[model samples]
Target: MIETVVFDVGETITRDDRYWAAWADWLEIPRHTLSALVGAVVARGQDNAEALRLARPGIDVAAEYHAREAAGRGERLDESDLYEDVRPALTELRGMGVRVVIAGNQTTIAGDLLRGLSLPADLIATSGEWGVAKPQPAFFERVLEVAQAAPARTLYVGDHPANDVFPAKAAGLRTAHLRRGPWGHLWADTPEVVASADWQVDSLTQLVEVVEDARRSSGS
Candidate 1:
């Protein structure tokens, strides 16, 4: 049975509109241009940060991030940023005795903001705080550590195939690829995603059904 659900923050439990819009505003570029560049980067299987570099060549992304913070404009998160289905799905999973964890490649500030929102999750963690990011075995190791469950019993859910599905599968965690965001929809039917993801879903609510079905099949 799936005893724990570890989630990726962006485009899974939360919508990333404000996050990218903030970056575009900080860069003084049209939001559409940055969005297109980000899509291009994702299509090319490059790091998403490469989009910012494309916008401003030779730019130090980390430095610019700090600069944005110094100017009183940094990563922002609140209830509005969360996907509507997140709370219901998490609450249902927790009610069913499943541990719900929110872990993703995000900044410590984003983690703090998420905590401030008081999401219905057992834990909320970020890459900045953990010093490891997605597609890293160590990162999945951390996830399994916090999950306190066997890798096979823990489900890692996200929207990115390469960063979320492939590595989590490599780490022996069952994965669910949610086809909600750009990266998700773009690669939803690709052979790699189809082969790697244990379950493919369109929403968090659907994930609840996945767990229920697994429990039923496992006689848990």
Candidate 2:
């Protein structure tokens, strides 16, 4: 049975795509260029530090993007109501006797952002504070260890294929791909990528059903 549901914060639990979109707009660069830069760095088989060096320009863009995101902190949006469902979903999962943990590539700012959005603060288990990042296998391993969760009894949910699903599967955890929304553009048309996920959902609401099915099958 899936005893715990681990989530990626940025795009999975919250609608933070505006950060990326702002980066692309601010850099005056195509979104694909940013993607290529990041992908090339990851493909180089270097450590995260080296990847960061290769991706420095994009990082600068990201800083500017975060500034913009921070500036509009209290403005709020009607469509942002999508995020309101997150806390209740987490509450329901906890009520079902399942543990909830957030595993994301965020810095200390993550705590503030979660608080600003009124998300459950206690659920976060991030790499930024832990000094790691996603798709690194070690990151997920750390989260599992910290959460006292076995790989087989945990599910990693995230919006990115490589960053979320790929490494989680490599670490022996089941993965659910949040297929809709802005991150959809990150996916490539490849058979391997397409077949990587154990389950895929277009919305977080759908996750409730997926978890219930898993629970029933496992007789939890």
Candidate 3:
């Protein structure tokens, strides 16, 4: 019946990639290099904290990069506008009787970022707060438990295939892959990757309609 809709914060609900660009600019490294470093750390089976430790060089550079980028961009870097369509989208879903929630990997700084963007604080569920990250089945399980929703009745929308689509599908929840912007590179270009998802949409505005179709097909 799609009673609950869970979202990822960073790239899904918020424009965090710009921050990644800021990080890349600060570190004076190509964004792809930092991404590769992060992927290598994860491939080694290290948790987020350990991965952060292993990727400290890239992380440190990214931090400095963001500081300088923020300084240089000034008002242009303001993310307040990012939340413009987000709230309206959620409101539309909520009006359809869907329970909106967030399941994301974020640190404490995420709170300030959400507040600055005027996102509703109560809608968030972060790894920093829950002590777990995505690509782990337990993370989705925990969010389902908190939302009091059954796997079949929930939908998870995210950007990454491994972290977002695969895990959510593994947990038995329908997944919507948001493939907007340059983040499209995160998906595998094979048929298997293409066939894994229940739905794929290029924009968040398309999500509500997808869910509606799922509901109708399920005869809910």
Candidate 4:
């Protein structure tokens, strides 16, 4: 049985509407241009680091990312940013004795921001705190450790194919591709990435059904 539901932050769980725009503005690129770059990165099955190089050659990606973070790029998240279905789904999962965790590659400030929202997750972990980020197996490995879950018994839900679905699945967790965020819609049509997800949903309400079906299929 899948005992833990690990969710990607930023766009998957909480809506940090200011984030992408902030990054784009910092890079002196229009938000639409940055969005296009993201789509191209996803279509090519590339990681964010590579996307950074492609976006601007000879650029210090890490330095710029930190600069963006220091500026509070989407650092302020609240209940208002959450989709209507988020809390109910989380509550339902917890009530079923399932653990819900917000696990994602986010800025260091994200931990505090997420915790402040009281989103009903049993744990909230960010890449900054872990000293590693997604698309790397190490990140998910720590997630499993924190959840005290076997990889196969965990379901990772996210909008990014490269950063979330593929990497989490590679680490042996079941994957859910939630289609609404930029990466979700941009890479939605990418054949292989879409095929990698064991489940896909349009909303958090649909996630409950997916979880139930998965439980049945797992015979637990």
Best by TM-score: 1
Model 3 lDDT tens row, 79-171: 553635577778788888888887787754564456566554246667877888887888987978876788888888887777787888889
**Candidate 2 per-residue lDDT over residues 97-203, each given as its tens digit:** 77888778876666445556545434675676788888787898797886667898888888777788789999999888876444534463346456877787776
Worst 10 residues of 1 by lDDT: 74-83
- Residue pairs with colliding backbones in model 3 are 26-65
Query: For candidate 2, which ten residues in a row score worst on lDDT?
Result: 73-82
lDDT of candidate 3?
0.68
The local distance difference test score of each candidate is 0.94, 0.67, 0.68, 0.81
Per-residue lDDT for 43-75 in model 1, tens only?
998999999999999999999999999999988
Task: Give residue 190's error in model 4 in angstroms.
Answer: 3.5
Point out the higher-scoring one by TM-score: 1 or 4: 1
What's model 1's lDDT at 156?
A: 97
Write down the RMSD of all candidates, one decimal each: 0.7, 5.4, 5.2, 2.9
Best by lDDT: 1
lDDT of 4: 0.81
Using lDDT as the yardstick, the better of models 3 and 4 is 4
On TM-score, the stronger of 2 and 4 is 4
How are the candidates ranked when ordered by lDDT, highest leading?
1, 4, 3, 2
Q: Count the backbone clashes (under 3 Å) in each candidate.
A: 0, 0, 1, 0
